[model samples]
Target: MHIKEFFSPDHTRLSFEIFPPNQRMSLKAVMASAARMAAYEPDFMSVTFKADGSGGDQTIQISNAVSEVMGIPSIAHLTCSGIPKTELPAVYDELTENKVKNILVLGGDSTRELGEDAYLPYAKDMVAYFRERGDFTIGAACFPEGNDPALSMDEELRHLKEKVGMGVDFLTTQMFFDNEVFYRFLEKARTMGIDVPILAGIMPITSAGQVRRIKDLSDAALPDSLLRMVDRFKDDPDAMFDAGLTFAENQMADLVAAGVSGIHVYTMNKPAIPERIVRDLGRLFHA
Candidate 1:
């Protein structure tokens, strides 16, 4: 199913993200990890291309394993980094042949040699290209917390509306520690008349050092209260993990309560973490 439709509030689906390992030796680990994650039977699983930092035949190989072997509906990250606008159609056709019906269109992260025009420039361009053929459901990134220096919230709204006009089916937000930001984003989106299902992305931070680094990298505007708790548990690994899980649970429960569309967990290729978070959340869902 197209992720946009899958994420509807009426459906309330949950999904996960995974990356193929860089080295050949790591394939065993990735397969084992996928096996473990598959046991959870999420609504769908997304295989990333060049996640955080990595290299591989990222799209075809990993997606084939997930969709063909695991028999799970897989969404592949199709990037516009360094590729010309004309090149995307073939990749889309390949994914379609493999039964991958969803794609997250990304302009990719900036790097040294990448220069200013490192990626497809803006997401709308890709959305326009894909919408013409209408082969796959297209998704684009949104920053609910508004960290992009170049674009204000209003500017981002304009960009989102443009993309929607270009046929963006759904949106997945960047990780934000606080729920208020998501609430604000949803309000703004509704008011602007961009009414696609926006899946909330949560990254459960498992360690204190991770919190510090992620805060800087993501511009994660966590509540000062969370900062204080992390400070207290900075050296306590077990406590840090507990706190991370707790934070994620609370955020998800609140989003569900607020009638957010769906949940997308950044599993980081470790099934145990996402498994634990989902298992814990299941009780609330039941209750």
Candidate 2:
């Protein structure tokens, strides 16, 4: 189902994100996680794409399993970072053949070096490229906190407006720790007339190492409140995991109470995280 059509103001849905396993041996465990997550009855689930496209086929296969076999709608990530412009149509065809209807286009982390002829340079270009084909429900990424300090908030908002103008169906934010940041972003986006269902992307910070990944990915500052938790439980794996879940639950509860359109959990391939959140939130999801 197209996410735009699936969304309604009357019902707030929870969704999960998973990345394909990097090793062949890990595939079974990842699939098992997906099955456990599927039992939670989330609105949908998404699979992350590899920047190098080496695992592009695996992305589609996992998305197909999530949507077709597991009976949840799915979004497959497609990155333009290192992929040739000519290769996108085939990727779209692969998703279409697999019965996948949603896609999240990202600029990805890789440096763009796909020969001199590759023209699709950014997420906006990918959105426009696939938009021309008029097939999928296209999603784009946004940053509540500007992606980099070099880019002014105005400049970031301007670029985001351009992406939305390129026919984006919806948006999911880069994971953030503060709800206030997301609120400010929503206000700015509305003022700019870039209206679309914005799913607040969330990652359960289950380990101290994930804090580094969050910083590297989005330059998101760790608030002192969360910083203290990490400091207190940094050495104890079990305690850190439990504290992380509680922190995420509180964040999600506040987001839901504030009426965010959706909550997109960056599950990190751990099924238990979302299951626990849904269980803890109870019917607050649809409230």
Candidate 3:
């Protein structure tokens, strides 16, 4: 099913983001994890693609399995930065063959140099390419906090508006800690006429190491409250895990109360994190 169909005035949808296994983990293990998460009955699950484009086949295989074998809808992430134009057809053919109809296009890490044959440099370009084909329900990423530190907020929203205008069916935000930041972003996006359904991405930071990694990878503002909690429990592994889960639960509860379109959890291949969330949120999902 197209992801857009999941949006409605009656209920807020839920989804999860997972990635392909790395060298250390076996494909069987990751598939087992996917099956466990699928048992939660999310609206859909998204499988991430490697930024370097080396794991596209694994991504396809997992997405196919999630949709075909697990009986759950899936969104396959496709990064355009490292994929050449010549190789695009094979990728499309594989997705078609697997009956994977949903995609989230991204202009992966900008630090990586684009190859000579790379034609799609930005997410907007990929949106246009898919718009012309009219075959998939396309999703693109947005940052409540601007993705590029160099660009002004006006510039960022203008670029987002242009991308959505090119026929993006929906949008998922970068994981954020502050709900107020997401609220402000929602207001600005609506004022700018970005009418598509937007899903708030939430990541449950389970360890002190994850806090450090999040700081290094994203420009998302870490709230003072979260910092304090992490700093207080930084040395205690078990306490840190509980604190992080509580923080995420409260964040999601607030988002749901405010009636956001949906919540997308970055599961990090750990079903227990989202399981805790679902258990906590309980009837809030239906209310």
Candidate 4:
């Protein structure tokens, strides 16, 4: 299914993301994880652009393999950091040739030596860039917390409206733990008449040590209730894993009950996490 299609009323969308391995031998493990997660039947899986801008051509092949060979929709994270805008056409060509139609346009990380600090600056530009030329459906990122005091809600909304104005088909968010934060974002978007479907981004932390790493990873707010769980179970790996999954399941349940259009799991390319998440969704979504 297309990424945009995941955001429908009757639909329940769960997605996992993977990074293409640099070595041929490790590809087996990546594929194994992909296949194992496939049993739960995610609506789609996304392949990330590796850090340091080395894997464009390789990521293209892997994304195609997962989408065409595995018979599951795959999203390409096409970042414009190290690569030049003038060179993006070949990237699009590779994706379309493989029949992979969905892409997440990212400004990506910094390429300072290249004298480019913004790294595509805004996703709105990326949305418009490919949209005017092709049959691709694009997804862009949003931060629900709007907590970056550096950027106001109005400013973020302005850019969001710009993306939609430029033909962006859908929006996913940076991970957020507090439902109230998401609700506030939704309400504000509604007030501003920003009607694009927003997929809720949920990152499930399976281990206690992951707490620091996850905090450093996304703009997700750490709720007190969840922090307490992490602190209490930090010593026991088994207990921490169970508690983490349970917390994530509970969060997903709340999002489902509150009528989120879809759910995107940042699986971190680990089967055990998505495996457990999929196992819980059956009862969580219905209960």
Question: Model 3: which residue pairs collide?
Answer: none
Each candidate structure's TM-score, on Cα atoms with residue i matched to residue i, is: 0.89, 0.94, 0.95, 0.90
Arrange candidates by lDDT, descending. 3, 2, 4, 1
lDDT by residue for model 3 (174-217), tens: 99999999999999999989998999999987878888988889
RMSD in Å for all candidates: 2.6, 1.8, 1.7, 2.5
Candidate maximizing lDDT: 3
lDDT of 1 by residue, 21-133 (tens): 76542778887888788788777788777654556355656777787788777787766663455556677677767777787887666352545453467768877777787
Against the true structure, whose TM-score is highest? 3
Error of 2 at 282 (Å): 2.8
Error of 3 at 189 (Å): 0.7
Residue-pair clashes per candidate, as listed?
Answer: 0, 0, 0, 0
Give the winner by TM-score: 2 or 4: 2
Candidate 4 C-alpha lDDT tens digits along 1-287: 56676566665567778877654427677788877777777778888776434655667777788888888888888776745665667777887788778988776764535556434556677778789878888887788976357888988887778778888777788887887898899889878888888889888766666778767766677888889988898888888888888988888888888878778888767788888887767655433
- Overall local distance difference test of candidate 3: 0.86
Cα distance off (Å), candidate 1, residue 178: 0.9
